[model samples]
Target: MTSDALRVAAVDLGTNSFHMVIIEECREKGIVEIDRVKDMICIGRGSISTKMLDEKAMQSGIVALRNFLVLASQHGVAREHVIAFATSAIREAKNQDEFIRRVKDETGLKVKVISGKEEAEFIYYGVRNAVKLGSSCDLIFDIGGGSVEFVIADSHGVKLLESRKIGVARMFERFVLNDPISEHEIKLLEQFFAAELVSAAEKAVELGVKRGIASSGTAENIARMIRSLQGVESDVSLNNSIFTRREFNRLYRMVLPLRSSERRRMTGLDEKRVDLIVPGLILFDTIFRTFGLEEIVLSDSALREGMVLHYLQQHYDAGQNSDAPDIRRESVYELGFRCNWNRDHSEHVAMLCLQFFDQLIALHGLEQRYRELLEYAALLHNIGTFVSISSHHKHSQYIIMNGDLRGFSPSEKEIIGHVARYHRKSPPSEKHVQYSQLKQRDRNAVDVLSGILRIANGLERGHRQNIRELRLACNPDMITIGLRSHHEPDIEIWAAELLKSWLEAVLHRTIVFEPLHDA
Candidate 1:
C-alpha cells in the first residue's frame, strides 16, 4: 500500500443491526471501502416502546459487537482506530449504562451511546458527502430502529437538527396491529408522526426546504420498492435516484394494500424490514406531504458513514486551518489524489483558474459562489485520464458527476461536471444531456467558468508550471492578456494562443496575448 493508506473502521451499534466497515484512507485517493460486515441483531425490536433493551436483545448486541470486533481485527484495524457509536435505543434505555459496561467487560470494547442531537449531526455528515446538499436548503431525514433524525442544512452548515423516538420499530410496537395495517392504525401512525414532527415540519418550511433526502434502510427500501413497482429488476443501487413525491404517493398506495408477507415478496424490500415497512412508509409519506417536498433523494450513507467522516475530519486532514474554511477544497483535491492525479499540475490549473476568475470579475458578473465550483472543476478536470487519455474530458465529466466531492449542492456539482467536461474538448452545447439539464442560470455560470477554465488549462499545457502570472487588459472591443513567466515561455504562449478563440467567443471580444518580462 502507498504511504498514504491508513486503515480505520467504524462500528455502528444501531438498534436494528450492528454494522462495521473497514476503509482504506489513501491521502490522495478519497475513501476506498475495504470490507463491510453486518448482523441482524434487532436490539430494539420489542424494547423500544418499553424504553429498555430486553435481556435477549442485550445478549444479541453483545455477541454482534464481539463478532464485529473480530472482523475489524482481521482486517488489521487497530482497536484504538475503531469508532463504535450507539444510537437511540441505547440512549433512551434506563439501563444504557449497564449495557455499555457489559460490552466493555465482555469484549474489551467501549460503546458510546450518543445523544439524539449528535446522531442527527452524524447523519448530516454522512449524507452531505453522498448527496450534493447544494446551496438550497435541504431537509435530510434518517429512520433508525428506535428514532428518526431530521436535519435542515445547506452547503454552509446545519440550520436545525432534531431526533425523535419515532422509528419504525417503535411505531410497529405501538400501532401496526393489522397485517394489512387497518385504516385506524394507519391514521394513528400518521397522527403520531405529524405531532412528533411538527417542529421539524415547521423548521423545514421556515427554512424553505423544498428538497428532501432520506437516508438509512427506510429510504433505500422506499427507492427500491418504487423501482420494483415499475417492473424493474432489484439489482440497481438507489443511492443516486431521486424519489419524487408523486412516485412516493404511488408506492404508498401500492404497498398499503399488501400484507407484510406479500410485501416481503416484492423485490427490494429487505426481509428483515418486512414487518416494519408499513410504518416506515407512513413516516416517509407523512414527511413528504407535511413539508410539501418536490422529491425525496435517497442517501445510502447514514450513521456508519457519518462516524467514518467525523473520524477523518478530526484526524487525517492536514494543512486545514481551524474553523475549516477550505474543507470542500481539501475534499476535492483528496478525490484527485485518490485518482492518482498530477497534483502539481492540477493545483497550478486551479490557481490560474481562480486568478482569471478574480481578474475578470467585471466581465463575468458571476457571484463568488461560482468560484468554488470553478476551482473544484479545475482541480478534478483531468482525473478522467485515470480511465483513459483519449476522450478523457467526457470521462472526467462522468467521474466528477459520480464522484462524492464534498461541499457542493447537486446543482453546483452539475455545473462543476459541465465545466470539467468542456475544459478541453467540446464547449458547452444544448445537445449535451447533462449540461442541458441544468437551469438557465447554472448553464450561464458553466459557460463563463468553462471558458476561463479552457484558457487556464491551455496556459498549463506543458504541465511544467512555466506560466507565473496572468494579467488581463479589457476594452470595449479588445481584451489583451499578458503572461509573465521566468523563461521565454514560448510553448505556453503557443498553447494559450490556440485556445483563445473559445474565450473570445464567450466574452464576445477580440482576444490577444503577449509575453511580458520584468527588467
Candidate 2:
C-alpha cells in the first residue's frame, strides 16, 4: 500500500449479479485494482417483468452486499469510500425505495439508484480508460439486466449516451420462453430490439461508429466463449480483446440453437449465464447487424469500474489525465511506486536503458516495440525489493508476472518479467526453467533486453543517479558508453565494466565506458 494511497470499493448491484471491485487510487498512479468479487445473486430476476423487487432476491442482494462490504473493510476501504450503485433492476423497480431503505438500515450502505443515462456516462468513463478510443467515434455499451446503456465516444469526449430497455435479463424474462429460444420469440425479440435500438443505432451511424467497445459481464462472457470456441484459451480478462463480426457470427450461429443443458457445457460459458446467454447472443448479433459494426472489443470494466472512476472524478483530481494517453508507462511507474522503489535510481536506470536501447537497436536487431518493453522492464527491474532485498531480482520477476499490469497481454507481461528477472546476477541460460520455456523469439528478446538492462543497472550501482546523461558511440568492433556526471563516476564505471559482459556476449561487441565532464 502506498502511504498516501486511498483504497475505495465500488459495488454494482445489478439485476443478474452483484460485483465489487476494491481499487487503490494513488495521486500519481491513478486507479489500480486490488481485488474484486462477484456474486450471481440474480437480484433482478423477477423485478425486470414485475417492476417490483422479489422478496428472496432482495434478501440475497442484501447478503451479497454485506459480504462485499466485509471484504472491502478487510481490504481497508473506509465506509465512506465504499460506494455502491444500483442499476437497471433496482432503478426501475417500484419497490426501489424499500430496498434502498433496507440496505441503508441493515448495512449502513446507501445504494444510489442511478438513471440509465447516468449509468451510460459512468460506463463511458470506465471503458474509455481501458480501451484506447483513439480519434474516431466508437460505440461503447454495457448490457445490464434491465437496460443496455450505449455511448458514442472518441478521444475528445462522448458525443452520445443512451440507455435502452432491451437488457438480457429483461428480454429473457419477457421473450425467452424456450430452452433454445423459439423462432417466434426470436422474431418478436428481433422486432422489439430493432424498434428499441433504432434511435441508438441511428446515433451510432450519425457519429460514424464502425468499431464498438463492449463492456459488462454479458460482453465479457460472450467474448470468452467466442475465444474458447476458437480454441484460444487465455486467463486474462477480455478487456480490450477484439472479436470480428465474422467471428461473432460464427459463435452466434453455433450457440443460438443450443439447448440450455447443451450451452452450459460450452467452454468459457458461465454456468450462471447459460440461459441468459441466449438473449445476450441475439442482442449482440443484432447490434452487429443493426449498427453496421466491423468488430467489438471487450472491456471488462463496466458499471463497477465506472462507479469508481466517477467517484474519483467528483472527489479527486487523480485519475483524470493519468489513464488515457500513455497508460503503459503510467502502469509501469505505478507498480514501481507501489513497491516503494528508489525512484531516482530506478528512473535513472530506465533512462540509461532507453539510451542504450535506442543507440544499440541496430546491433540487437529488435523491433521498435521491444524498446517499450525494455524501458518498462528497466523501470520495474528492482520491484522485487518490495518483498525482500535478498534475491530481489527473482522477487521482481514474480511481482511483474502477477502485478496486474494494465495495457499488456499475458505473453507481453511474461516478456517483461523475464527481462526484469535477468537484469542482475547470471545472464539468461538454458538451465533456468522459466527462461527455457519461452519461445525462441521471446528468449532472444529477453537475451538482448536483459543484457542491455544489466549494463544499465550496473551503471547506477551507487544508486546516487551520479550519471546525468549518456553518449554512445558504436564502432565495428567496440561500443563505447560515455557518462556525463558532475563528479567522477568511478564506482559506476567499474560496475558497468564488470557487468558489460552479458550485453557484449549478447550483441557480440566489445564494450568500454568513458567519463565526459562537459555538461
Measured by TM-score, the strongest candidate is 2
C-alpha lDDT values of all predictions: 0.83, 0.86
- lDDT tens string, model 2, 231-323? 887566665568899999898889988999899888888899898888898888889899988888887777787788778878886665543
In candidate 2, which residue pairs clash? none
Q: What's the distance in Å from true for residue 219, model 1?
A: 2.2
Expressed as tens digits, the lDDT of each residue in 424-443 for candidate 1 is 86788899877787899998
TM-scores, all candidates, are 0.79, 0.87
Top model number, lDDT? 2
What's model 2's TM-score? 0.87
Off by over 4 Å in 2: 1-5, 26-34, 70-76, 183-211, 226-238, 241-250, 288-296, 321-326, 361-368, 426-445, 505-508
